[model samples]
Target: MDFGVTPHDGLPLPPRVTICEVGPRDGLQNESAVLPVAVKAEFVERLVDAGHTVVETTSFVHPKWVPQLADAEDLFRAITLAPGVRYPVLVPNSRGLERALDLGVRDIAVFGSVTETFSRRNLGRTVGESLEMFAPVVARAREAGIGVRGYLSMCFGDPWEGEVPVPRVLDVATRMRALGCTEISLGDTIGVATPGRVAAVLDALIASGIPVDSLAVHFHDTYGQALANTLTAVRKGVTLVDASAGGLGGCPFAGSATGNLATEDLLWQLHGLGIETGVDLRKMVDTSTWLAGHLGRPSPSRTVTALAGTS
Candidate 1:
């Protein structure tokens, strides 16, 4: 099907979009180089200064699982939390939630999976067991009036289980919402999604009483489809998009997964389409370039490479 927008299609593009910058958390977590807590703190500060309203700062997952972000508490303590900017952290379970609560985190996210294989592999639990584990976490966070975001991964396709159906994604998404998640981020984990599939998933969600405003899209550029998929989502009235600076993340567990949709690249597309993200493109590119230097390599972001001469 033609994914291009026509005036008569009854699909008006969003005037503005909120970019949830996941560079410091998701981006850094998958990297081979473990940056210092100070550097990670600076990265969070830089993203906020560049006009990112919501930034995923760190994960409270155990050190054994993700050693790179093991200093979650230290990083949270080091960053100077700015006013009016959200700094959400990922909490794997109640223990993770306790750590975040101890540090006074106002926003937290729970990661879930659509496919059983990914759920088992990523969380070491079956689909039901994972949600069962998240039940109390979500309940506690809601009780404390914290903003909870549910990230549903492998929404389009999974590495172990090839193609993921729309219903399967909807089931997990619905459960997550019922569990008191304020927002649900649909993750194209391996980036195998195309415009058609993107539309199908959004359509299903909207038809099932899920509001478009509460939905977010997280796409990977593994198959070079992240931008196209994002455009399709925006045309469908999705206002929140998740991206990482310098294209710096992949699923360490899923070998087929590649880097996330680069924040710079997504900004280039959104700005070109007359969408307001409140993000300064130049500053974002500069931040990515600086980060690439610390990582001892150039950024994988096309916009960053083209504008900043990171090579």
Candidate 2:
């Protein structure tokens, strides 16, 4: 576990990276099958056992919008919350926030879109309107001693809006920070971002006085550039990255969107680069393999596919 002297493009990489595993929440939300609440709880426990310190548990969105995770409250109650590990759930509005607070949840995430079209389509509000809606939720969470993680989706590209400008992404991110979000995860919803594009976006955010420590990269594997783009972000001093266990979920709003960057795939790269993630790759692969069976499909992760001999 010695992360010794790993440098990329002359930039000193972090000795350890904090990976927030999004499998239980983001990964399963888009699946067609509704997994039992107990199964989802087991999935979260397995991931934490594999050394993921931060695991997104579930979303409090209306069951009508995402029927798959309708059991968010039950799943949250079922998880055996480990000491020193964070279990953040996605809260779309004040109602969601109220539900999480009722369960005594400490960490929660709010999602916002950079593009107007996507904001309206996904959340049924304009970009400004959605931010306006999240403002009170963020404020209320802060008042209740809860930490808020902001998710800025469609940071690189969007299906309806095409390519999104860096400033537009930065604007929403800045607003989230101003609204009391502890960290903002920049999401490549369509997975079209390359290394250069990732570098440019990170550079812009850093140049605008947004500390790299306050940001996390969430890349999708749609065009298979997720790992490369993530590497580019790490090179730019991004210490936090988001990945799913089995590369589980896709964007319901974006037609061409695919699963997220797999935890096993990202762990392989991090371990190869001598960066400490504290994750057991084999265990993670096994967890994904187990969950894949429930979904009745093979894991979308390259590392899992290779290790499980399913390729």
Estimated TM-score per prediction? Answer: 0.96, 0.96
Which is the leading candidate under lDDT? 1
Candidate 1's clash total is: 0
Shift in Å, residue 93, candidate 1: 0.6
Model 1, residue 51: distance off in Å is 0.4
* RMSD (Cα, Å) of model 2: 2.2
> Candidate 1, 274: how far from true, in Å?
0.7
Q: What tens digits encode model 1's per-residue C-alpha lDDT throughout 1-311?
A: 11222344566888899999999989999999999988999999999999999999999999999999999999999999999999999999999999999999999999999999989999999989999999999999999999999999999999888999899989999999999999999999899999999999999999999999999999999999999999999999999999999999988888989999999999888887778899998899999988998999999999898889542
| lDDT score for candidate 1 against the true structure | 0.93
lDDT of 2: 0.90
